[model samples]
Target: MIFMYMSHLECPKCGATYDPHKLTQLCACGSPLLVRYDLDKVKANFKKSDLIGA
Candidate 1:
């Protein structure tokens, strides 16, 4: 299953957003980028039982 709920990468300091599908290094301010996800979509598509084995 292709579970890709990641929407973008955000810089904690500069609040800059980057495309999550691309290879990104860091923000313009040299801050490490953090992943942002579509949590609502993930919750709708995923279940807690899905992790029972893996």
Candidate 2:
């Protein structure tokens, strides 16, 4: 299952947003996109140790 906190992709420079589950190219403003997450929700569900082997 997908993580509940994984929200969407966003362009940091232009503030453009895109669907996280889909493949997306660069934003129209020509900036690289980044994955956005709900940090509070993620923190509630995951532990730092979960990343040990990843």
lDDT of each residue in 1-41, candidate 1, tens digit only = 33388878999998999998786869989999998888987
Which candidate should be chosen as best, given TM-score against the real structure?
A: 1
What are the Cα lDDT values of the candidates?
A: 0.82, 0.80
In model 2, the Cα lDDT at residue 36 comes to: 86
Leading candidate by lDDT: 1
Could you tell me the TM-score of candidate 1?
0.74
lDDT of 2 by residue, 1-54 (tens): 345677889999989999877867688899989888888777755665477646
The worst-scoring run of ten residues by lDDT in candidate 2 lies at: 44-53
Off by over 4 Å in 1: 1-3, 47-54
Task: Count clashes in each candidate, considering only residues at least 3 apart in sequence or on different chains.
Answer: 0, 0
